[model samples]
Target: MPEKPPAIESFKESTKSPESELSPEVLEKVMNKVQDINEAGVAYSFVSGGPYSAGSIFEQDNLQKTKLVRILKEGLLGTPEKFYLEGVPPTKEQWAKEAQVSLRKGGRSNVYFNVTGMAHEEETPNTQSGETWISKSAGSSKKNALAFIFDLSKFTYDDDTNKMSRKYYETYYKRSTRKFTTAYGFNLSHRVPPRFFNGILLKLQDNYQYDQLAAEIGILSEQVYKEKGNLLLPIYDVYGNLYWPKKMSYEEVKKFVEERDKNKE
Candidate 1:
């Protein structure tokens, strides 16, 4: 455990008195939770107000996330009254209609479902760009919808899990407008690759050599960046981005082929 860093203290202060401020009680809970993390020796960093995000926070360990989830669920959502519940749950037909409307308006994706175990997709409104058809079951309960709200940014692989996670979490049902406002939260997870390197790697995709070298290279790359305070044998585009080369390095390409052959070993 270490003393609270100056940056972390500043973050706590800013959250306490921000333009869109949290309540004193909530702020205290947040500060305490952050202190607990620091005391537990968890490594973390925070980024605020990205275009697609409110805040982007990263931690070294998954345990930190599990602990934070419990704290937020109990602290911010302490009372049953803070949430909305349906006594007589909506009918399946009503749920489907709501889901279809939501999918149509989502813009970047289509909706898919299985009928007699055969998959079918509802077409996207705009097809100029690639759209993925994400299948989800209709929400039957508030708790289910809350769980969906919690996992909105998570990418689940299992069909059942993905379906459950993608279900809409309806917030306000405007009678006059005949519309539902859905609520969701975002978390930036560890699974995403680093910001700069992915495009180059994507071009060499399906090459086993590239996969092995990339897996082994990340640590080595970080060490070089830290010790020398410079990039390794730099190549950059007009925008000074690593992605500018527009081709995999010859050394990496050769190693990629070599590694592919050895994978048969």
Candidate 2:
């Protein structure tokens, strides 16, 4: 027999609207409609040397960010101002909290809460500003974790399903990139190019290289949510360990992510 899909509840309280399910693929015209949907580029801006990098687990490099740029290219373009940011490195706690409500909402809360602490020093860093955010929560890096930039203008909404789809891709991407850009303010978003974005995802799939076909499906699942509300996943017959954001211990998260690639027999 096969393992069942993992059921997850969203951290936030609000209910996402119900959506009609989509098939494994979309028609040609629908593809064309969303083809020119977003700005063409990666969301990265340079820091001191070039694109600041964080080590990745889900990907070899930061390919998830590239997928993000593509999603937002269509959605965040020409939207109203969510908020305005001042610089590359957003101001610390006191001011960031004062700026916007959502900015500090998802930040590191407790040592156990932190999901970004798994990286080696090379994969994660918080040196300066202007590139991406590596802001850890108040104290001990265990619970209060996750690195993100402090900008507001980068967020946008849409009548089309791109926002939801992009968000889904970004959700997977954040697990690896952890590299959040701050500018407009809502959350992770930016405007760059396709090559860098493509390069990142390609590098990730090339690097760790999972055996399942989820990577190919990931691109399409991302697009499907753009059209319909529901998503389907290819549950490979692999059982590793288990992890929960708040429910499980650190050991659990490690096991949970590992499960996707661990079982093969």
Candidate 3:
């Protein structure tokens, strides 16, 4: 594996330290488990602190978020207790609740995969924003994320799930007391176009298959350019950034792929 680039090393250092401020034993276990997941080339992000969010982290001040937040605060949370549970499973009722969240958030439908993992999310009476951690589930969907909330005092999270709902591993620094929300970690439904998928790939050193998936990123990018224009190009860099003037067409990309493949000869 290549040495950590200076940029990524700095990023890792900042996020890993203060976030690891949890108790020594818990922190050790958390990092070790995350490392194991990293080594396994699992598609996941180790997130800490920020707004509670779900789905694409694009767009802001969305009116569609009220349902998930309301349900989380006032709906079906079970009683909290000493030391929390070692592990808990989701009930069918909770799954149905997720579907409702989907509709409220402008999604066409809801789908659930069996999942397992821990997460935390919270909203406070006095504060403008909240935070969460939606773990990647080891189950069918791969990365089941967590949601969390912290008032001036208490901190708590929701059970992780794979179904496409919002508030997955979200966190926020400052939002409006009057309106809006922020997302801390990753947006699960967020995906890069095929062409740039390879370009923005993560966890490559851990597995060769990662290369296979990303090797065609250029092709995917071309496809997106043809059909969707530059709508999602910024996903590779940052939100609202386009590396190229506009997306390229499929035929143009196909020719580029053929030319690149021939160059290996």
List, residue by residue over 113-194, the lDDT tens digit for candidate 3. Answer: 1111122223211111111111122211222122221111111122453544443322121221231112222233221112
Better of 1 and 3 by lDDT: 3
> Which residue runs of candidate 2 sit more than 4 Å off their true CA positions?
1-248
Runs with alpha carbons beyond 4 Å of true place in candidate 3: 1-98, 101-170, 175-201, 206-213, 232-265
Model 2 TM-score relative to the real fold: 0.20
Cα deviation of 59, candidate 1, in Å: 23
Residue-level lDDT of model 2, residues 126-200, one tens digit each, is 323111112221211221111211112232433343332232112223324443222211223222211122111
How well does model 1 score by local distance difference test? 0.22
Instruction: Candidate 1: list runs displaced more than 4 Å.
Output: 1-49, 52-246, 249-264
Candidate 2 vs candidate 3: which has greater TM-score? 3
Give, for candidate 3, the lowest lDDT window spanning 10 residues. Answer: 234-243
| Count of steric clashes across candidates, in order | 0, 33, 39
CA lDDT of each prediction against the hidden true structure = 0.22, 0.24, 0.24
Question: Among all windows of ten consecutive residues in candidate 2, which has the lowest summed lDDT?
Answer: 236-245
